[model samples]
Each structure stands twice: as C-alpha cells, then as structure tokens.
Target: MDTTSVWRATAPKAALPSLQGDIATDVVIVGGGITGVTLALNLAEQGIPAVLLEARDAGFGSTGNSTGNLYETVSRGIHRIIDRWDKDVAHAVTVARREAVDQIERRVQKYGIGCGFRRCALYRYATSEEGKERVEKEYQGSLDAGLRVRWEPSLPPPFHPPHGQVMVLDNQAQFHPQAYVRELARQAAGHGCLIFEDSMVLEVDTDQRVVRTVRGKVSAKHIVLATHSPKGLHLVQAGMVVNREYGLATRIEKDGFPAGIFWGSGVDRISARELGVDDETYLICVGEEHKTGQEDANINLDRLEAAAAAHFHVRDIAFRWSAQNYAAADSLPYIGKDATGCFIATGFETDGLTWGTVAASIITDEIIGRDNLFAPLVKPSRFSPVKGAKGLVEENVAVLKSFIKDYVTDRPGIPLSQLMPGKGDIVKVAGESLAAYMDPNGNLLLVSPVCTHMKCKVHWNSVEKSWDCPCHGSRFAPDGTVIEGPATEPLQRHFLQDVE
Candidate 1:
C-alpha cells in the first residue's frame, strides 16, 4: 500500500465523473492539489466563478503526503536563497511564507476544520561547530531581514558533535493536511467553485486562454497552472520547475521528545514531529531535499531513517512517503500572469503550504485587478541573468536526460513470464530498473511501477505488501496503494500477462 499519498488516506471521496462536453466558466484552474484548490477557494471567496480541473483527486500531491508542518521560511540554507535571489526578494519570500501559514490558520478557524492544527516552533540546529557558523549566519540574515530569531547553544541528542548551536522560530505549526484541504475544497464547492477530478489536462492554449483535458475543453477568461511543477508548459519550452523531498512517520515509544518541529542545517536536513493517529504515537520525520530528477530520492530516506533510529525509540514504522516541489532557478515561486490570460503559481520548492497560499492570494488579486503584495517577488516572467541562465542550463539538461533515459531507449522489457502467481519483482520494467510488477494468478500488472516523484525505483516491500520508494520513502500497495506522496499519480498498470 502506498503510504505516501495523503489524499487517498485522508480526504473524503472526490467528485470525479468524466467531463462530458464543452463547458465555459469565468476562470479555469488546472491541478486540484493544494495550490489549485486553494487558489480556487481564494477566488471563490472573492465572488469569482471558477472551475478547477484536477488530474487526480484533490490534495493528491504534496498536500496529501506532507508532514503537514508549515515551516514558514527556508529551513535548509538561507545562503542558497541569497545566492539565487536578492536579499529583498528573499525577505519577501519569507514574509509570504509566514502569510501562507496565517492564511491556513485563518481558514481553519473560519471553517472549523478538525485537522490537528497547532501553533508550534520550528528548530534548525547545526551538526558541527563549523555548521554553527552557518546557523549563526542564517540567524543574522533573519535579523537583517527584520525577523528576530533565537539562537540556542548546546542542544541535546541528534545534534552530533554537540559543540554547535541551534536556531528556533516561534508560531510555526503543522496538521493533517488532507483533512484541512478537504474542508477547503468543501467550502469552495459551497462558495460556487467547481472541481473535477481524474481529469488530466493534456494541452493548454496560452494564446487562446483555453485548457484541454483528456475528455473536454474549458474556455475561460483566465487560467491558473498550479500543477505543482507546471505540467502543461513543458510542451511550449517555456520551462517547468522540479524538486524532490522525502518524509517518514514512525511509531515512537519514548517519552520526553520535547514536542516541537525539529530540523537540521546540512544539505540533507532531518525534521521530526509528534503526530497523532488514533491512539498511537507517530513521529513524522522529513528532509532529504534535492532537485527533482536529480538523484534517487530513496537515498534521502535512508539517511533520515538512520537519523530517526539514532535519535528516537521506534516502536514500529507507521508510514513513509515523499513529495516533490517545483523550484524555480531564481529561488522564488512563479506567481503571476505569464501571458495575457494565463497565470501560474509554481516553483515554490518545498514551501508550498505557505507559498501555495501566497500564490492563491496573488492569483486571486490578479483576477480581481487588485494590487498584490507578492507581485514584486513572485513575478513569473522575471528574468535573472545569473540564476535564470544557470537554472535554464540545469533544468534543460534534466529534461534532456529524462527524455533520453525514459523515452527513446527501449530495451528488452521486463518479462512477465518471470512473475509467478502471488509474487512480485523489482525487475527491469519501463526501461528502468526501479519499476515493479506482481502477479496474483500469472498476470503482468503495471502500477505506477516507478516512483514518479523522483524516478526512484520502488521496491516491493513484502512485509508491508506495498511498493516502497526506498530513496525518498514513498509507499504503495501491491494493488497500487497511494499511501504516500510527492507522487500524486498512482502506480500505472501495464498488464503484461493474462491471468489463467
């Protein structure tokens, strides 16, 4: 069972029926994940009649598989932001992130959604004395950005080489993101917003401001491409964003965990939190950030699980998942009108919860013809001579790599004859070794077969009876269980052998 897909586990049954004929609306939003749904909700609140098209069910992307912690700022490396984006831009991004958290909180209170919402602090600690300098530099950056942050020296365990320090910011929080988004979707539906699931958008007419899905076409005055990484824009060579992240939830038996959101300062940081599911205790572990299509996401999970075992007493493994975010090379989310009628809110990296909210507000503001505070920082068409050049080279290189590796090279496909009844194999399928297949009665079944989030080879975890993305920690069942995410899509089935 894939434990990585949060929407499958948390959200109510989605309203998905094949879209019939041509429909017209004032605005059409593609991608029903948090960004898309939240954008729709924002627009509805402003009395706009918009229709949302989701490739799958709502909250089926990072929102479903999130650790649900709304870390309002860059927890990884602030220096990276300064390197790619201007100081003012970085500062505005931070403020926008905080505003995202505030928006979520406000919506929760307004709708009375029961999603385990809480106000907590986020801690970023350094592993070594050298790392302490980096942490302090970030602290100073926070201050220089007019945000006061507290520095704590001599932290407890999990801080290897303990001579280093830590930084903590208050008022950060987390929750069951699926439940929260479901409520948002319900409210949006009540407020005159239409959401259609299982509607994969195949094309977009930026010139005409029209969106075409597998079933029907939608003609609208404006369009919002909030599909995490801009799925449809790739055909146009306008560029799309991609980044990979991992998360895990473990059953903890230990006491005195210090109950707050915790993270590290290294490139592959680790975050831990106490999560409640029924009567059991689960510690949500997250980190292992990297560019999408850059590396095997499972590697991050191994590193984080090792850290979790070292730091906390585990009773059992409850769930593990991964998420991918679109990181613009400029280190800012693309949240504005691109052409005349098309708007986008992507490249948010891993801060989508906050940035998604920012995107929603800005996109709504754009539709309403109001001045948006985030306009200056999140311009979609903004060009950065240095970052844009580097990002273009890097992203295009990845696109070329994926195209060559995933598409053109067709070798001997996985032999379904090798699969036996009631057995599964991580054999070479889909031209990649990470794909898996199983047979209940001698039939070749193709599920997501591969982890779409980071192209990590998913392992058939027999113990869990699920396809586990060992790299970034996403899990799905032999029957294609989307228990976790970053991967909103399921293990697509390619039946190779017939059951006899």
Candidate 2:
C-alpha cells in the first residue's frame, strides 16, 4: 500500500538546500526532472551560469515514475507519427532519440553513475489475434523508422509465449531513472550550477524573466520551463491530451525474472521490464493509461495489478505509483519557445525519457546561439491544425465541458456533516460548493473546487489524495497547495468552525 515508486524508494538520496535569497543567472531552469537537470549540467559545463529550481527532489515527477525503458520508438507507436507527418519525420524523431540515449550512456560511463545502466533487447509481442496484427504493424513501423528489427518465433521463458511472432529491437537500453537524475543533479551542482530543492516557483514574470518562489527569486535572461506541460497556461496546453498511467514493481528476487523491455499489445497492453540496480532486483510492469482526472484511479490501478499478476509469475507487489503524460495534437513534442517567448518542453507523452533528453539538447543549443538540427521540427511556434486537428478539438471540447459542468450544472453536494472520515467530496456550505475532506481525526479541510490555471473544476483523485483538473491536468493537495501541472497558484481556501 506504500504508493512510492520502487526506483524512488530504493535510490539513494542527494540532499540540496532550497533557494534562500534573490539571485540572477544567465539561464534559469524550472523543475529538476531529467530535462532541467540535463540542461543545467550542459549549460554550466559550457561556462554558462545556470540555476535549477525543483519543487521537490530531483526526478520526483514522471521521470522517476517512468518504466525506465530507453528506446527510439514512441510508446504510442512510431507508425502513427509516420502516418501523421511522414516517414522522414518519424526517422528524425528516432534518430534524435537514439542520440539522446547514447548521450545518456556516455554520461553514465563518464561520471560512473551507478544507475544500473545496461544495453538490452526490446521485444514487442501480442496475446490476442488483434494484438498479433498490431505487432506486425509495429514491426513494420520500426523498420520504416530505420531501426534494426527482427522477427522471432515466440517469446522466451518467464513469459507467456506470444500468440504469434515477436518483434525484437536490439541495442535498446534501460536504467534507474531516479538514480540517474539525482546523479545528474549532483554533477551539475559540482559544475557550478546552483540546484535548489523544495523551492517551488509561485510566480513567473515572463516580461522581466524573473521566477519567484516562496522565500526567494531568480532572474535570468533565458528561462526554461522544463516542468511537465510548462507552468501557467500556455497555448500548447490547449492542444495536448493529458493522461495518467499506472506502474507497479514486485518484491526483490534473486532470479527467474525476464531481462528485457517487453511490451504486450491490445486491451492487455502492458510494458514489462526487470531491474538489477544497487544490488536489488524488481520486476516492473506499467500500463493502464487513461485521461487524467476522468477515470477512477483505484479501479484502473487494480486492473493493472490484475493484468500484471495474470501475465508474469512475479513476486508480491511491493511498490505502486503513477505518472502523467501529455501528448501533442500533432504527434510531436513542443520543445522550444512559444508565443509567450519562454522555452517550454512538453507533450512528450509516455516517451519523455528520451524526448526529455532530446529537448535538453535542443534548448541548450538555442540558448548558446548554436544550431540544432532537430530544433525546427518541434519548435512550439509551429501551427499545423491540419495534422493536429484531432487532439486540438478534443482539448477544446474538454475545456468547454469542464466549464459548463462547473458553471451550469446543478451539482449535488454533501453537507459538511455528511462527509465521512478519510474521504473528500464537493460539499454544499451555505449554498456555495467547496471541496471538503474529512481527516481520520474528524477534522475538516475545505477549499474551492476551482483550478486556478484556467478556472476549470477539480476532481478528487482517490488514489493520490489530491484534486485533479480535468481541463489541464493540474493537481492540488487536500490543503489547496499546488502539486503539479500548469497551475502556478494554489486553490482558494475556505474555513468554517462549529458548523456540522
């Protein structure tokens, strides 16, 4: 029941002080995930003064919650990219991602980061008849994307053998993401980059290039909003689809676990991998993706656990967590300056591990006045409604629906006294709807159910104990504190006393 990720719980910690006073630097990177930390290290090593601000510790976001699989293919399948754009664009995406993975390998070797970095083969197999066809298509897509792929008769032991052929891609890699990002932060700090932890940016003044936290602020010429989906409402958020995926890891075992990235197909879509890091081993399985804030978290998580148990003969589930991803309307991540003029990296979907590195490389080049070949492809300014019409329309409709439900519908709310212990709900208080949560100690915490990012209604995420925005994926704590997503302001708080 400990929802902490296995990577985060097992990885060693690197404690860094929070930002104290006002400071100015050449470049300021927000959010200390892989992208921000990599950019900080790359910039500082080149004699550029940079600083990184993290709301929590490094890699505490989706980066650490990731499956830790590194490959050139996107999780949604590269074939869709080719169909949306062209074969050339898909090839470019794969090439850029491969280079980023190589760069990660180089860093692991150069810095001796003990993150269980290893080269392994990735296998894509199917279980049902429909899934068999999907594997065939994915195999063709991999080849079209200029990857070295082959077909195997069936999957090996420790796996439910495929219903048909298995597509194998060699040279794919995996690593301990939490450990790698933490090590990258340490190295960046050693290279003169001021890395701050637990310093959440409360305000971003784009006009003055200043970002202010609770107790400190940083002004920089170049601002990189490496936070997932970017902070505050951006034009890109209007064109992206946000989703959450579940991940679970089994108890440490000595052997009998598979040693590759295995992705199953169809309604039984599950991505599985084994890890041997820091003298520990775990079999990790991740899948079950749904639109954020729109689905029952407990049901989705339980379904994933059921599938994991059905497929793999693994140990007891030890750790369980989830990750949020944003897919762009045009099948590509927006990785550069937008209309607001700040560098933003988002919409990487579930393939952010490789895309995050590619984004860091591209953004670093742009700030240093160097040309990166892949920069123009994913620049945030590009508008391709013809290619992105599907996602754009869905995003707009979702926003409108949230607004209407929050403003138009007659919402049935429970009275404060009817709110049960260890539960949260929208309660009617003096004719106003407010988010109310009752603690185990019989204490009540109340806050507005409105998300500050875009005035969208917030829904309770039962699994994570937070309020999630169905509009833009912003999440807040039960106390109205901002957790993540594009919301920079916390929810409005309401207090009541002696009112059952």
Task: Specify the highest-lDDT model's number.
Answer: 2
Candidate 1 accuracy as TM-score: 0.79
- lDDT of candidate 2? 0.90
Q: Model 1, residue 30: what's the lDDT?
A: 82
- Which ranges in model 2 have alpha carbons more than 4 Å from their true place? 498-500
Worst 10 residues of 1 by lDDT: 231-240
Best by TM-score: 2
Tens digits of per-residue lDDT, candidate 1, 381-465, equal 6777686667677767766655555446732344545766666665554344434455555554556456765555565543334
RMSD of each: 5.4, 1.4
Candidate 2, 1-500: lDDT as tens digits: 35799889988887999999999899999999999999999998899999899999999998989999999888888888888898899999999999999999999999999998999999988867779888888788888989899999988777877889899999999999999999999999999999999999999999999999998999999899999889987998999999999999885566767678899996689999888766677889999998888888999999999998888865488889999999999999999999888999999999998999999999999998999999999999999988999999988888788777778885578887788888888999887889988877888889999899988889888888889998889999999999997999999888985333
TM-score of each: 0.79, 0.98
Clashes of each: 36, 0
